[model samples]
Target: HRATFTFDLTGMASKTTNSRGMLPDMRSNLYAAVLAGLAYPGINGHPLTEAYGVRQRFIAIVTDLELPNDPLTVLSTCDECDRVCLRACPTRALAGEMKQLTIENTSIPFPLFDTFACDWAKRYSLNAQEGPQYWGVDESYPVPENRTAEEVVKAVTRTDWGVQKLHLNVAEECLRVCPARGTR
Candidate 1:
């Protein structure tokens, strides 16, 4: 038996006390994708943009009980609104073209994104264009054109602020500006 649970994290998106404070949804999004993929391989387990309409934390459990497979229903209203998430990304992480991921004959279409760029803006909150100033962060560290996890870590650690300021400020413009939250 496989079961999936979701907990809404939209309420915390406005909090700015720490970088992770507003990142529960993003973290949970990844968790949900992994859990779902493991529980139901070959199904639509990939993270779809429509699912972010409302930030949700997910948990999946597999038991020894027989259960019927239930199709996941996602009520997405993104088609009606302007693509604010794409435009709001300061690092142009979400600027890539749309791509499709197919699993077991199920084709899932999603926006292509640069993980490094997204992480640079969200984890460090150093992109002034993403509104780090709102969280009282004055320093705007330039994001390297060729970004990598190692390089980003080195840059952050070498700074006077160091890792202590890692959670001081964060940007979630894409999630914050999503109009799908209202539907929830």
Candidate 2:
């Protein structure tokens, strides 16, 4: 029989984390899709950063027995939706626009995302206007709209739960707006 081991990389130390805050050299994508059984379309038609926001690392043992391959993830859900993420973003980070990426002579449709704006929102403010309420963060933190990205990062990093140490910050409103997350 074949065996597989999967490790959730969330909250992993920065030393082991790559620039993306994920464990270096781990093909978590393939294993996350296979094991978690939940993946949605992400930026540039790629799989979502993690299956349900839980990053994973995997190790598999090649054995005499072969296991069936998992079914490929489909992007039907996001494609058919009303684009809540785009509208819900307080910083307007996700424009309701489709971008094309060509791979192996095939074109794929993905959302137009603004990472800098997203980072600004997550690091700086609670975004009480259009975004979800982040009740967990202390009220003393600087408001995001008035601050720069660098300032926001500095403020959050100094907290007891920074992205560096605990990976905590303002709630991810875009990810939370997705309906699939709730059903899953």
Residue-by-residue lDDT tens digits, candidate 1, 3-56: 544443223221223554653335334433532442111111123334343454
Which lDDT tens digits does candidate 2 get at residues 70-134? 54444565655676766777777677677665533445454656655554555344343322233
Off by over 4 Å in 1: 1-52, 74-76, 103-106, 128-131, 157-171
Q: How many backbone clashes does candidate 2 have?
A: 0
Alpha-carbon deviation at 2 in model 2, angstroms: 18
lDDT of 1: 0.51
Quality of model 2 by C-alpha lDDT:
0.45
Q: Which ten residues in a row have the lowest lDDT in candidate 1?
A: 38-47
